[model samples]
Target: MDSTYDLMEVLNHIDPSELNYQDWINVGMALQHEGYSVDVWDRWSMNDRRYHAGDCEKKWRGFHGAGTPVTGGTIVQYARDQGWTPPYDPGTALDWNDTISTEGVVVDKNWVEGREVTEPRQWDPAKELIKYLETLFEAGENVGYVVKSWKKDEKYLPADKGAYGRTAGQLIELLTQCNGDIGGVLGDYDPEGGAWIRFNPMDGKGAKNDNVTDFKYALVESDSMEIEKQHAIIRELELPVACLVHSGGKSLHAIVRVDAVDYPEYRKRVDYLYEICKKNGLAIDTQNRNPSRLSRMPGVMRGGQKQFIVDTNIGKETWTEWKEWIESINDDLPDPESLDDVWNNLPDLAPILIDGILRQGHKMLIAGPSKAGKSFLQIEMCIAIAEGKKWLNWACSQGKVMYVNLELDRASCLHRFKDVYQALGWEPKNLKNIEIWNLRGKSRPMDKLAPMLIRRAAKKNYIAIIIDPIYKVITGDENSADQMSNFCNQFDKVCTELGVAVIYCHHHSKGSQGGKKSMDRASGSGVFARDPDALIDLIELDTTEELMKQQENKAVCDACRQYLDAHFKWEDDLSQDDLCSSFQMLNYCKEKLDKWQMEALERNIEAAKAKIKSMTAWRIEGTLREFSKFDPVNLWFDYPLHTLDQSGVLGDIQPDAEQAPWQRGSAKNKKNAKNRKIDRKTALEEAIEGSNFGEKPSVNEVAEYLGVSERTVRDRVKEHGGYTIEDGLIQKSDEKQDTGKPD
Candidate 1:
């Protein structure tokens, strides 16, 4: 996703809990609905929403310096708002505080030099909760409720009393008359006058004339930068204006007021704007507005015509009411500026918080099959930090977080928050410190945008970014080690520079991880598993119910050869019978399997490095065999290995293949050309074909079929070919050919 995606909001809602966990979730959800990614609550001192919001302002002076002359008021507003009351009184009086200033009883900051008012670093969590609760109230009104309009025959609202029988036009005219200015407002037109002069033998009101009067709105046509040169063209005429970017160029809209056009010189007035536009070289949309037809431009959507946002069958009054409501809310209601002020004041943060965010800052992969809750888990991470709660039910170093959830709506996110918040049962204090970005319905380049967004979200504190599902944002070749490596390397640098943890929720590779390393389990880039400071992999386990079914006889880790000294245990609280508990069992399985996979990957990396070193030694020996001189200074050395490639000593050297230089020059390498050996390509292709592994094979059978050492096969396809095997039929292929034995 692009920087726009970073602007997206977190999806979910908050509740009236004392803990504020749910509220944190609610902020995330709202942002999500609006298309922002957000982090969880970090602490409870500063509120963040206001800080991230927009407002018009003019600074009193230049940037504040460390130590300068300044004015100020009381440190706390509640105390300053009134006198320092005896009970829970503020230490200093608002007016007397030399550093602070007060105006009309409003607290203003003092430009005092060197006066660092270091407040707490927590965000106001209550705001996020309140925001969500407010949304719920709005939602309640929208749910299973309908707005019915008084049809064409009806002219008055059902709520009207004495005037219920009056026509809409009559009501409007009467209401205007009652306003106490008849001549200035109505002129010669009677309170109940004006029959159609032409087609309407009877009077006409917004009667769906179907006349379809095609009138050009906004005259045409300035080309390129000319409009900017003569920018005065836009405001010269009075019309509702809008901005549109067409063909990568900018143009402003001018919607002619329909009501203003009903005059003696109506056609002439309309024609003037049209002629002016044409003279100015602008494109006039002649077919844009059809009088009597509600369809116009986007925002000009009439009442009962604005399909997406307002009611379709709504009467003009209801539409007016809705508009009035929106206007009143937009204009009169001021954001409390509670948590946001605090969140904005916090100092920068480091990334090591929360136990090094899902494993150091490296390209940590959170791999799990679809429906495995990878995204949910990542969001949970956001919640923990934003609220300064625990991660995965465990304590973690906490800080600000930025979650980019390209999936899930704000509403669904709210439901999730409700579930988690109901579980926690408390509202928080410092929710505002957490920042959010809501990005939806966008085709943006994440590589181009993520860094900028990450930088922006790092206000006050460096922000931890968790992209739930790396594939969603990444656009380049996910398989290319170079491209993927560079992509993740950027993140590594960001983590170190901004001191913000970076976590990615990734999908696991297809099939069961019977017994193997799951680095390959990470979706998309292998580098995704390579880059980050650390990585955490997730797995799904059989539930308690499944375990009970197999309770007749079961084996734990060691007994089942999955782990050393691991023992199977049962819990009566969660499980139905002898089976595993639905949630508990799944969690256990995920932990166990996730750890195993991670460990296996670590082992492989170590093995690869060791093998590379050894192979380099071995290759040296072989190179010496070909050289008459011990030092190959006499011969050209074209190993094609840079410092890193040379140092990457791996234990798992190619079976019948060469090491670095060898891999670079072997016949097999030449054939492989663009990338990797044929074997690797064949392996990837095989994987692509398997799609679903279906039934697995025994390890021995697989080792025999592949013609490589069993240990070697385990090193490569451990999860697929090892413990996952069932019978002797180990080899698999795509589009199986018929043997003509059955069917």
Candidate 2:
């Protein structure tokens, strides 16, 4: 109501021609606020602004003659309701209803009333592709069209034979007819993975021939993506697309227009776009790079879902514009020349933890047959590494270790750890660096467990994480290559991102014992062994049987020697049957030989029995057969044995083969050596701290205090440097300024 009054007052005084665009908008808003509908304003404002030049004059007039106001007929009332009335006689402006008269205006309302709007038709890809080619070449150029289609079951139907000498419109018609019956029409001459694409059409017979086309767009397939996200990416990239289709079931295919001079340029542009999409979390099917890769017809039923059109913001762009878009996004790809500086870069292998057996930023597997005491052995090794002790006879690098027991209950795992702890003479609380996580009851597969464990690993920074029995966490069939590969990649992702070593335990396959190759003995797909940086197989050995066989051979030697002496008559007890009863003499020799054989066999057996008895007294039992990636030769060591002895511990037992240097050390001796180094460092620190600065002590005094050579004391003091030697005596420096030097 207020706007109506205001608009009316303005029309009475102000000329519409005097207003700028903003003033016109203000007037329109006022009229709308006052219930002069948008339809009325639009109807009046449809043509040039000049048309409303006389409207304000017609709506209101003041003092036609002295002291008199003249108003028009009902036209004025109608116009007032519309917030403005035009300047025209009632008979001319209105029919009986006081509405605008179109009698003489010759309004063309039904020019095409019964027909469809014949402007540019909706973008039919089949037609547009032909048009693009024709434009790329010239008029009367040999522009070709190749139409391929698929049957209902996705079986390739016969392609429309090469149609030559066709205009863009004619080709479109041909494709339209094919699309009507079959699933869709493909413009690609060949729609296979490595199709040789060109602009020239080949008869289905000559499709493989190399005929180059002047222009082609790269087809990209991105599946299982959000439409909104796709739109956002397109908007961001501003790519000039030939056509885009929602090609059924979470898949979208795009034909991106590329302005490339040759095949190399085309491929480069396509690869760049693909990488960009990949970097932005778009699951682009990288295999869809060929120019002849087919795309779904825009308006067709594909598996009951429509391969409908998506508005490519720049779909109809000219070659020049498309080229600009390509060049803008195509960064220079990495080349061998660009990597020249990296040619001489040295390999920086991660730090070794147990020489060749273990290292940082890698994964290892320790597998064995059932009841080989592998779990016990692995637990012992883990405890040794965690507590800065040696494992078996091998040196261990000390750090925090986590035991993820996925195959054993908490109580059982604790019991095993307790056994190893008691054997090592360590209190439970002393295992501060070791953590056991019981994941036995939980059924979280690797897919679900990887992220959680990765987060935990990042937080804990454990030097090595031992997942006992890897099968518990693996989700799919281990025999399935696809499943296992994906699972292994996921695991690798975790280890690489976390920068921690992962050690897992696994079981040997049934009847795989005594396999010559240590890896062949592992269960599941070869990936289980192939994927790890290291593999350790703890096998059982038959040391007792072999030792007994050796003893039996020695008995045979003794028996032969005794029989030879008796038969040759070197011993007086072997009389020739008391002076030659020929049968008796033969019986006597045979009897003597038999007696010696039996007696020697018994004696040697008793000796073997005695050795077994001695071994029992020394607590030596079964032996363990060991094989690893670190060494090719198999080794056998005394089992149920303690490696913690500090002295010449290997004196009591024997090895089936020579030991490697890494496997030759005693755990306690290594520990004691490490302790001595620590003690020396500690004593030097004490001597320095206890010395009076006013009476600073010399290196000799420090050496005497720690019971070491002056050179050793001086080296130790220098290694822990925080002081200076002034006049042969060490004194703390008084420097106040921080130079940011390494100490």
Candidate 3:
């Protein structure tokens, strides 16, 4: 066969670590072109690259020189074809034959002692966990592992539990290998969602029993909140102000905790106030920072180790109690309020607008349907946000973007990110602003995920955080509406509480069916759509016109119009005429459908009366008389029925009893009626009942008597709740069954 140039190129570019089957074929083809013969290459790797033919190691040969190709010896050649000579010495062929003969014996031995022989140990999960503990220890970081496999909210590791467990920690470490530094607790800990993470922070602090009562705030980078603007808003709202720099989050979080202890209250009260700031172009940080966890940026010191040079409020009195302080401060301020507020109120892209949004952050919602480009969009977003570019030339919010993907195994995820970074023409996957959350996710349910995600988002100070598919972290059965709603609500709560505008990637549900809107089409409920401040959906208008107009009656874009646009960005490579035809089809079909629906509605009322009448002869006549009175195609403006079917509701469906009395067929199904007979059915059942002699029959006797399969006899026996159909004897369903006859 002629060698392929493309194959050669592929072979040249092959990485041994990930050599695919096609690569092997290319290599084999190349080797063949290079004069190798008699054997095929398979099972390739650095440790075990084969130099033999299929399942016949008897004639296996080794490469004598780096430049020389290996060949299968004469024993295999003789077995395949009689006329063959060894390229090497005759002694080599003889040795090959001997080894070939012995190979069978080895295989035989293995088979004979398969169960009894010592076998190689499989992977021990317990040992895997121990090794991970060593990694932390080697890094001089102290941590602990706790198994809360039952419920998520339960404590991770009891405070008294030691530094780390060998087994459980290894599992966490293995999970880390699957995810990354966002290493999380292992097991199905949560019926809700999240994971438990173990890592001793630089401050040597661990879990504490402090209730975060007043503020349901999330930690972000120092730049998350536009401190100047938010402070001004606090003054305007006459609410409290708090900006704290701690070990908890990436940004120096400014907690605006009011009387709102829960998310709903926060949304109504605090979220409203925050939106006002955002509306006038105020930006806020929304990443997570937790003192109990390790810092995302390794060297970004906290706990007053390093001081800010500019000293905006370097050593200012920290306001732990923002409510009282803000109430006091806002009561009396200078003439035009504050310096920043005065500048912001008179805004036309003013310095105050810049000042309001100076705190940079990125929050993303990486969404797509199954096989619909979720990860592609995520990596693209990461590259763009990382590179500070617009998404497909659309304007984008600024900040380093944090990409947390739970769907991928760690190695694959990193590899994909590498490709994305390269595709974006980036030499390095790491940018100052790009953070990928690969760690701290549990394949099974875990408690650590939710808090861990928020914390990671804050720690990175990512202006935008993109969680792909959203199902990975909040993975309940997203199919259930309530589960879907709760998940949405929880995520919304987390995002809102954290002060991040999270772009949560979600799957758009299946095609519009039965006039369900996009919001209704979501796998979950209105809560999934309601939780997000804004939801952007990729429109999948049916390529075929017959499909698009299928949703003509109720507006497909209704519930979402108030929040998001029903934007259709055509993705077809088809010509303009095709596009026009498609559009026209949608419009035409919709019109046709409207007319059909109106006609159907009127016709259905009469048809229903006819059906009710048909159930009874007189009602059928009455329905026919009413229907006959109307003109066939004329408008039925004065038709009586306005509702679809009141019978479906609690309302009764009354009709002429003489014409529509409940049919005997509907009273009880025939098969069930016979089954309800209980003691008697067919002649066979009666015969079985009378034939009982307090003795069982053999399989052969029963098989002979029934003239059926032994399996059928066994089944019959089993039908009467008996096991071990000895000699194929059967048991009848009737309790009094008896087949009395000597074999």
TM-score of each: 0.28, 0.37, 0.26
lDDT of 2 at 728: 65
lDDT of 3 by residue, 79-184 (tens): 2222222233332333211211111011111112211111114433333334333322334343443323233233222223223333333444555565332224
Worst 10 residues of 2 by lDDT: 101-110
Relative to the unseen true structure, what is the C-alpha lDDT of residue 456 in candidate 2, on a scale of 0 to 100? 56
Ten-residue region with minimum lDDT total, candidate 1 = 193-202
lDDT, candidate 1, 98-178, per-residue tens: 322111111111111211112114322222212222322222121111112233332312111111122224423443444
Ordered from best to worst TM-score, the candidate numbers read 2, 1, 3
lDDT of 2 at 243: 57
Judging by lDDT against the true structure, name the best candidate. 2
TM-score result, candidate 1: 0.28
Deviation (Å) of 289 in candidate 1: 46
lDDT of 3: 0.37
Please list the residue runs of candidate 1 whose C-alpha ends up more than 4 Å from where it truly belongs after superposition: 1-351, 356-363, 424-430, 543-743
- Per-residue CA lDDT of model 2 for 55-150, tens digit only, reads 443432321232422222222333343335444323333222222211111112112121111213463544434444443334443433334444
Candidate 1 local accuracy as lDDT? 0.37
The alpha-carbon deviation from the true structure for residue 378 of candidate 2, after best TM-score superposition, in angstroms, is 1.9
- RMSD per candidate (Å) reads 27.6, 34.8, 32.6
Misplaced by over 4 Å in model 3 are: 1-367, 424-430, 439-448, 475-486, 492-498, 511-516, 541-743
